[model samples]
Target: ILEEHAFVDELAEREIPVVPASRIDGRTLHSFAGYRFSVFPRRGGRAPELGDSATLEWIGRFIGRIHAVGALTPFQHRPALNPQTFGRDPFDYLRNHGFLPPELAATWASVVEQALEGVARCYERAGELPLLRLHGDCHGGNVLWTPDGPHFVDFDDSRMGPAVQDLWMLLSGERQEMVGQMADVLAGYEDFCDFHPRQLYLVEALRTLRLIHYSAWLAMRWDDPAFPAAFPWFNTQRYWQDRILELREQVALMDEPPLWPV
Candidate 1:
């Protein structure tokens, strides 16, 4: 939580549109009863409409602004979003715990291995990336659109990673549709920070990693009462089957040429 506060403070210093932790008697975090609490004022705004071209472009501009600041420095303690952390470590945990259904374990393992190989290929193509501090989980839900513009919330997932870590989640729909969306986003994004076309290679690769990481997260949290109640489908045969299917699709998608902005 302290790391989140520091990163948000950094963005706030640059005048980025973001929600910052409110100071309580000059202390950003207050410790009480063996727990830490942060005070953030309730700000009003609705979830963004990604389908709207104007909104997409507008949101893209602010993301670009955030990246411009993000590129200026590195996080002191946050982990980098990478295959090892997002892919290998999580998979190891799930496998050791026997999270997969016995009958489908081999099938899921095979698909995950293939997906990781594809992720590797994509990374190789991307080469060495220009890593920077990132919003880490910059999906539309985190972006609240007000009359002035969008204000990003939830720095808890913030980490050091490529700029595309923030940009890719904004894209949606079929391949052709995503291409058009990328054009709209980059139109505004390029206004602030320079973007590398090669980073496109990580688009599907990163999505695959998120999939693996999400399943692991769900399994890891299963001991918590909320997880079982909320994600009842998890650990079921149908869930594993669906995940296997998704990874199969991701393997194919990662092989396709990246959606480079025109």
Candidate 2:
């Protein structure tokens, strides 16, 4: 929590369109009954209309600034979003924890294995890109859009990783559509930050890792009672089937050419 608070403040200092943390009686964190809490000033806005090209470009400018600041220093305490954490560890846990439905277990494993291998190939092709602090989960949900611009929130998922990790989520639709979206985003992103073209290879790979890691995240929380109730759709045979199909798609996509900046 402290790390997240500090990170938000750091980003805010750079004039990034982020909601800053609010200190409680001059302290950003408070502890009571062995629990910790922090507060942030409420910011009002709707989720950005990602379908709008002007919106994507506007978001790209702020993200570019965020990345420029992020690249200046490394995160000291946060985890790195990499194959080990988001891929292998999650796969191992889910496999060993009996989360997979019996009928789909083998198929799920096979698909995930192939997906991870594809992730590896993408990484190898990218070849040791710089890792920096990133807004780890940067979908439109985390951004608030107003006529002025976008404001990023939820630094809890901040981590060390390639800048593209903050990018790929902005893309959607088919390959050509995503390529166009990438061009629109980079139209503003490059104004402030120098983007690595090679990181493009890791987009689908990162997406693959996120998909695998998400299931494990839910499984690890299954015992909380709330998890099972909230995610009843999870751990079902149908869920595993969809996951298998999703991973297969990712594997193929990762093998395809990256978004070559339009």
Candidate 1, which segments miss by more than 4 Å at Cα? none
The global C-alpha lDDT for each of the candidates, from Candidate 1 onward, is 0.90, 0.89
Question: 1-262 in candidate 2: lDDT tens per residue?
Answer: 6666777788888778898778778889888899877777888889898888999999999899888888887878888999999999999999999988888889889899998999999999999899888989999999998878899988888999999999899988988899889889999999999888999989999999999999999988888989888989998888889899999889888988888741
**Which run of 10 residues does model 2 get worst, by summed lDDT?**
1-10
Error of 1 at 216 (Å): 1.0
Q: Candidate 2's error at 29, in angstroms?
A: 2.4
How do the predictions measure up, each by TM-score?
0.96, 0.96
lDDT of 1 by residue, 47-91 (tens): 898988888899889889888888787888878889999999988
Off by over 4 Å in 2: none
Deviation of model 1 at 27, angstroms: 2.2
Clashing pairs in 2: none
